[model samples]
Target chain A: MPRYKITFAYDGTKFAGFQIQPHQRTIEQTLKTVVNRMAKDPDPAIPVIGSGRTDAGVHALNQVAHFDFPFDIPERSMVRALNSQLPLDIVVKKAEIVPKTFHARYNAHKKRYRYRVKQGEFVDPFRRNYTAHYKYPVDIAKMQQAAQDLVGTHDFTSFVASGSQAKSNVRTIYEAKVYHDEALDEIVFEFVGNGFLYNQVRIMVALLLEIGNGQRPLNDVKRVIAAKDRQQARMTAPASGLYLVDVSYDE
Target chain B: MPRYKITFAYDGTKFAGFQIQPHQRTIEQTLKTVVNRMAKDPDPAIPVIGSGRTDAGVHALNQVAHFDFPFDIPERSMVRALNSQLPLDIVVKKAEIVPKTFHARYNAHKKRYRYRVKQGEFVDPFRRNYTAHYKYPVDIAKMQQAAQDLVGTHDFTSFVASGSQAKSNVRTIYEAKVYHDEALDEIVFEFVGNGFLYNQVRIMVALLLEIGNGQRPLNDVKRVIAAKDRQQARMTAPASGLYLVDVSYDE
Candidate 1:
């Protein structure tokens, strides 16, 4: 068997998520179906593991995954064939043969995610499906201060959603930053972390948004993390604005 | 009656075009519907004239139009309210009261358009609906050279599609440039013209693509234009990648 790592991108607007669930349309299932058909394997049973699970309506700009095949297929040909069969909203960008030990999920070294919010009276119609529309005013400087408070190792129990079943909530966030793009009328929140609790990014964004909107003080984010209770965090922002931008792995 | 000039954006995927037909969904019809309802007149006859007609499946980033209303409505407020009632894909970005002499179609000084093509094995799933996928290798320098040859005044009969009803084929093209973005794996074809004949831009793109693909020489574009026959052009590029980027007017 040969293992190949594939890099892809998706809109995630109409997809349930990256993982395939029974009877639901997902990016994983769509990719697997096309790959199976192309390989002409009756029992495709190809197991594809993504770098991380993205929630419904979340996008990915450079998502990496790996799968094994029974026979050899040209990487470039596989990319073209898969794209021909997949829906317009999903694309397989690059494929390369990797060592047998390569695992997209477990071997990942770091992950970067981006959340985009439009701050204006008018939303861009072309980008409305991809960016969250925050019509209310926000203080960019205050939000940047709040974002700084989230960069460090912490037990993110407060940031995790209530339904998350992870055994431990400890994760190391290397960096968290917020900036404004005046030309595009957008606010961008970027996070690079070793790992994240479920809904951690969204929760952090909600807290920063509260601070930006004057509902909470800039130091409230630190207080919430120290509290270690889910109730202490602000609401989770919508998933539409979130994007799993990149995943890195050691060679 | 008060005349207003409105700047708008639309997805154009679901619209037949900019003009209203007997039984087709159009940008004009959608805007007229909203205006008629807001007027509260049983037979409100609000007519909207767009700066230019864009084909179905083409998009617009900054489209201008004009309409007349009998009653006074705050320009900004009307834009917000109209956007609230309109579909998510169409947005009124700005609205302002203009002099009665202002005409969206007739007063326009120039227009700019962009055609996007993805020239890689893997197409971004999110942008598939908005970009044309070209898997073959493209010579960007050759494409740029060919595009440069298309600038300035020319009788573009060779670039017009067959069955076009335009009375004149002479049009002034101010600029045509093609460039590739390596990070995005995309090529953007931008054009600025005083006016375009029917299917002129699409035909130009098709010819440039041939040049890029090595099917034709760079100077072949000049010969094609001199031929002044619709059949001299290569092929009509798909409409998905075409966008009406901007329409300018003199103050």
Candidate 2:
């Protein structure tokens, strides 16, 4: 059986999340059902592996996944056919054959997540859902200065929720930066990391926002990381404004 | 009774149009229902008058309208209250008391409509409804030349569908211009006219698109105006691409 790597995009408003559950609608289960139904050789079902799970109401501009098929299907045809069956909010962007050893989750080298923030007196009606609206002015210089503390390897247990039971919380953040687009009145934070713990990105964003608003000191990020306590990181940003932007791998 | 002028915006996907009907959903009907339910001094119902009727699936950025109220309501409070009752897709941007004789439809000096076209091989999923996808390279210079001829006063009977029973087809076009946003892969046509006939904006957009694609000659706009036959203007563009951008009036 040949493995296929698929890149997809979804609006995230209509889905529960990228994982399967008993009664809730999910992207992973929806994709698997569509792929199996459309396959030339129908099966009980095909297991679909995702690079990572995105929370409900969290959109994905580019999400990578992999699945095996009993029969051969052209890459372009697979994309076109799957998109026809999937809901309009979810679209299969690209599909291609991959090596048997290639794994969507295990073989991933790096991932990039983007958080959008709209800081102004009023939120643009059209982009209200896509951006986390902050009704006050954000200090860009303070945000940039605070972001520097998170741009290194550290145990990020403080950023993750208490429910997570990971053996280790060590992760390396390659780049942590914020870019403001004046035309759109939006501030986008880009984070590229070797790996992220559960709710890591949202929690980091919450701290950054606090620092930007002058509520928290600029060095709070470093203190939170060093404390290694979940109670220290109090806020977790909403899922609606986070997007899994890109995934990279070693060839 | 004091008349209130309202400037509003709507996404228009779920709405049938701006008018009330037997069973279908509409922006005007929705507004009236909300206002009736929220009024401290409720009556039979308030009639909401729109500056012009937008076709089904057409959006609006700044559509102006008016209605009568028995009691005084602050402009800011009215906007906030109406918005709370309206759906997320529709928003009342402004609400203010106007002259008793200010009729939304008849007192207008000019109306501005915008048509968006995206010329690209692939339609972006995010903006599929907002822009009409034209899968070809458009000649900007040709579109400009054709637009020049479309400006100024002319009898536009050729552009109106047979269903319209207007007294005269003559209308003055104050300005007609096409702006290309290369970064967004969109071509926006802006028209400020004294009035437009039924289906006039869509038909003009279709003709402009044909001219931009080099299918029609630069003089086709002039020839079609002289023909005065609906058959001369063969195409009418989709309503999803049109927007009621502005409605101007004398102070």
Scored by TM-score, the top model is: 2
Report the lDDT tens digits of candidate 2 across residue range B97-159: 998989999999899999988764445555666778787777877887798887889999999
TM-score of chain B alone in model 1: 0.96
Please give the lDDT score at residue A226 for candidate 1: 94
Candidate 1 C-alpha lDDT tens digits along A90-126: 7778899899999999999899999999876766777
Model 1, TM vs. native: 0.89
Error of 2 at B223 (Å): 3.5
Q: All models, DockQ values?
A: 0.50, 0.30
Place model 1 in a CAPRI quality band.
medium
RMSD (Å) of each candidate, 1 decimal = 2.9, 2.8
lDDT of 1 by residue, B1-251 (tens): 78889999899878898888889999988998888788775454878889989988899999999988878889988798889889988999889999999999999989999999986556556677688878788898899988888898999999987767889888888988899765555799999999888778888988889899998887988999899887888698888899999999997
For each candidate in the order shown, give its overall lDDT on alpha carbons. 0.86, 0.86
